[model samples]
Target: MPSKKEIEEVLKLDAEKRFSYTIKRIADFEFVWAIGDQHGFANYGDDNGNVAFAIWPFEAYAALCCKADFANCKPEAIELDFFQEEYLTDFKDRKMRLAIFPLPTDKGILIDIEEFEQRLQKELDEYY
Candidate 1:
């Protein structure tokens, strides 16, 4: 799991090119995560109920790169289906569900940045 500081650094590096897409751990699953954007404020789950990992500028760019498969990734041309139905589904038999809202945003995990980071870190630590 990436630490808050690490995430912050990554976000900082990606600042100029804001990564509006978000990837979050699926609720009720141990190793399921999803990738999506913040549109319509759709609720993937209860606010602050599930743990969201990262919000990247490129779709599945972080997940693929984190898996050390950077050579095969083309973020600019990546699609959600490329990740959801193909890659992420292998982790679990069901579909990959992603929340529509960004972290620390209203209607989903209403909290400050520090608290959000702390909660994510805590959940990750406990999971490991």
Candidate 2:
């Protein structure tokens, strides 16, 4: 398990290695400013091993939530809750989820990353 600082350090290193891009912190976690897409979410860890932040970008609106992860992951995983979209309205002002899993893998081919990303990009491109 890595401490929050360790995770941040890795993220920083990853960012430094990039040729060009900008990532900033919204509340506690870092995120790359996305122009017109909600392709995926950003997961960030803190110096304390007890907490993490999940970032969601919705049609230019960003929401941040803090969550607890008993399973410390260097690359924070993504997941979907067992509820409907209405459930998200309840967390419009929060930072964490009751559960988190590796995203895209939650559903079948239609809802997987490959498909979902395509839809997101097509939608986001319209804004470009």
Candidate 3:
């Protein structure tokens, strides 16, 4: 668990840094956090019809967004391998985007699924 100050510091980072942080941390931990309820996982949709599935590198970080649109949801951890194999394929098929490290106030980084996958893959590849 991250301390309050650490969570605050991470949240204070700019969107780009937050995105990079999410990628690196998820790669390091082999899991990502997302908010969901009994119905299904939470997501944001815009007028343009692009749905964004938000993820966080830490459970504490993900807990911060459980208000407003996600008030009924709770943070759930998804393994990196399952995310890469199952969710990515479904996301690509649906043309969904990824919202990296979203906060209560900020929307974090909105990235295309394929591009986000590529970035994560690169991080994984560099370690092996």
Candidate 4:
């Protein structure tokens, strides 16, 4: 397994522009990391009463791996609303729609952005 520093280093790649449209972080609870400062990902209900997208770990991590806005993605259909409300960004080109979620084991797991992309695409093809 990669050390925390090594993993952190790898997860720090810039992966915006890869996905169409812009994203920025929001002032919401989903943005908060799980216990131990470890973050999770999953869309939750918003004031608008819609299911939004939520990326786990962090945005840069999501970008580096080629994952789409967790909410914008759906195998059922390529509908943006299927994901989160609006994506988040720390800076220009360094865009993302990430979130911090809770892990069942209470252990944070760094997500595979690439794998998330693949699975999402498959979901698009198979379901959507």
**TM-score to true structure, per model:** 0.22, 0.23, 0.94, 0.25
- List the pairs of residues colliding in candidate 1: 19-56, 19-57, 48-109
Candidate 3 lDDT tens digits, 2-89: 6788888987899999999888888888998999999989997666878999999999988889988789999999999999899989
Give lDDT per model, in order. 0.35, 0.27, 0.89, 0.31
Model 1 global lDDT (CA atoms, 0 to 1): 0.35
Question: Model 3: runs farther than 4 Å from truth?
Answer: none
lDDT of 2 by residue, 36-58 (tens): 12333344333343222232322
Per-residue lDDT of candidate 1, residues 1-128 (tens digit)? 45667566544443222222132342113333334333311123444465333333333324443223223332232343454455434423432233233333222222233443344455556556
Which runs of model 4 end up more than 4 angstroms from their true locations?
A: 1-101
Each prediction's Cα RMSD?
Answer: 15.7, 15.3, 1.2, 15.1
In candidate 3 the C-alpha lDDT for residue 68 amounts to: 85
The TM-score obtained by model 4 is 0.25
Question: If candidate 1 were superposed on the true structure by all CA atoms, what would the RMSD be?
Answer: 15.7
